[model samples]
Target: MTDPTLGELTVGVEGLALLRLLHADDRGAAQVARAARMAETREVLERLGREPSLRGPLGVELGLREGYARWAATYDGPLRLFSIEEPPVRRRLEAWPVGEVLDAACGTGRHAVRLAGRGHTVIGVDQSAEMLERARAKVPGGRFVEGGLTDLPLPDAAVDAALCALALVHLPDVAPAVAELARVVRPGGRILISDVHPFLVQLGWQAQFPVGDGRAFVRLHRHRVTDYAAAALAAGLVVSGVEEPALTPEAARTPTTELVPEATETAYAGLPGVVIWEFARP
Candidate 1:
């Protein structure tokens, strides 16, 4: 049999690069490559497309370039929608008397733009270049650095206040990142974090199709509220408040709802889809 054509080899190499970026593990990439040989690349790609992470499901087939680019492009829309509606949250943020603010994990610059508009000097940091690109377009005045939560590029005690909105849930261990946030802010500076309630994280979601007796196919990491508080404390931050804001009764009738279903909405109504916590470095 003739050897595979150069185009086929190029495709396979591209697949390998995608696998490497998705897994960030050499052993895992090798295993995925072996599996792809048994199953066609197209089939592999189809499976990964369903997952949130690059390595998720048919991710290998999607290839690194396309998968990463798509993630960067689509991330801004949902983030803006979720953040723009929280007027109370925004109000509290505006109340803080700080000239310099660091919006850590500031996806799409929703909060960053708001803060900048209020005349505060803001620096937005995020790992995804695509997200940062969108954020830059939205808030040209605010400085944006492309980096992870655990390692902020800013100097020590660089900012008067730091805000992390709906971004902690993505990190594997919230402690180190929290510590980094605390370290960057001056003594008595405040840190605000908002994320999905722990209960919501525990209640897993089902796929459209049944997989393994119709059980929840994916289990998201649900870090406890107390644990998060402890992390803040360990990082030398004093917790001031923890609140679960209510969705207005009138706001409920709107066609675009943040709540998923009756049960979920009820649960979220009692417990917030967003939890806001305030901390101060002593």
Candidate 2:
């Protein structure tokens, strides 16, 4: 028999609620939280020894456009991932030349606003119109466009620096996007790409957020560090630096209403949580 509210409790905050219930008694909730974290409601139910009433894929691969449209509203609202990302990204950008900058996949202009404020002429691009709209408002003087990393609507060698934070893993193959980034950035210019380290993915963790009743998981492709290096080298970009920042006790202590509490807080205690790469267009 199905848990009557299983559908509502399988994704996002709702899903966490279910786990919190189980976590009260079953230490295994942590395991299930990661194993079934962002999968389909029915599938998770089946794993939990129950029959589901609704039958379907756990979550559709929404691609970038539809996915961002759904995610834009809450992109930076309920969750607080910047705590893990901002410090390293800001550090990398600090050494970059203050010139024309491109924030590829500039979701909600989080980076754009920061770059523009620091005297860099920034153009933000993303595939989601909704996100671009938010980006436009967040950085009123900054230019925001709707496009993608693999096919940016920009001329070759157009910018002095480009920052694509946490966007590459969404692609099945990374070569074309790296090639595209290489093409757009002038020689000696820089490109910084960040992603959730592949180790967590291998352990069944995923990037997920709540939709209506359930959480929607971002369809992610695990890219080993070697894969990124290979793509960057083939694209004529020099790999200047690679930083794999592990989860910190400080960040974990930071409070948040994050959905789906996986055992990773403990399992990933001292493991890499993010991979930030710095590349030179030369």
Candidate 3:
């Protein structure tokens, strides 16, 4: 079969028109249009917009108005502080005798670049073409593919190790992604996944604050630690270890503290912003 056309693969002109109408800004519209050309972006936005829970006033306020855009901007600053730095996850993978590594949902190729730098053949996959473009620029030697965590295009047992960092929370279902991760890695190979702690989701801290009212303060997605484990088991993987990385007090300081005082340095340092799990495909 021929590959889908760019318009067919993406949101198409119709969705782009809606985005333009909602945003009411040419710049945002242009950006959305550009992103919609990629299959992943089209899928994500369509899924997000089509959810029943995401309709009505709350949906308009949270999703269409400025929710995703706000979160997207935070990736450069406040969110960056909470991201997984090179050393911790990198050390664990480098210690293993793996050759080919797959960085699923490899945002900006941070970990993928590090893995490649350590002489591992790494392939980075993400749904966002915009993100993959950035990843390609950052990690020139590594291969970057456009795909979702649930529907990977690679063959079965294709890699020695697979890593996913801070990407699963956005997915509506974790089981499919977990199964895909297992399917792509060889038996006894490792699958490392790190995501925002479920506790943070339960606490309703995933949503941005300082909205007109607190209506958007509630949790927007379902995230449970047990579900993650179950997904792994169903995918025929054994959980080897689970770890929570603590953030330094200094690293937690940010301007958003004014809006989320409860998320102060002292409070977050004791909580798990990042949770890492090791799964062995068996």
Candidate 2 residue 168 Cα shift, in angstroms, is: 0.5
Model 2, CA-based lDDT: 0.73
Report, for all candidates in order, the number of backbone clashes: 5, 3, 0
- Best-performing candidate as measured by TM-score: 2
Q: What is the lDDT of residue 92 in candidate 2?
A: 84
Expressed as tens digits, the lDDT of each residue in 68-95 for candidate 3 is 3343333334353345434467667777
- Each model's TM-score, in the order given? 0.64, 0.75, 0.66
Off by over 4 Å in 2: 1-61, 78-80, 249-264
Winning model by lDDT: 2
Angstrom error of the Cα, residue 193, model 1: value is 0.5
Q: Where does candidate 2 clash, by residue pair?
A: 11-215, 12-215, 40-58
lDDT at residue 83 of model 3 (Cα atoms): 50
Q: Report the poorest 10 consecutive residues by lDDT, candidate 3.
A: 3-12
Worst 10 residues of 2 by lDDT: 252-261
lDDT of 2 by residue, 72-138 (tens): 9998873434567788899889887689998998989888888998999999988889988988988
Model 3, position 247, has a per-residue lDDT of 60
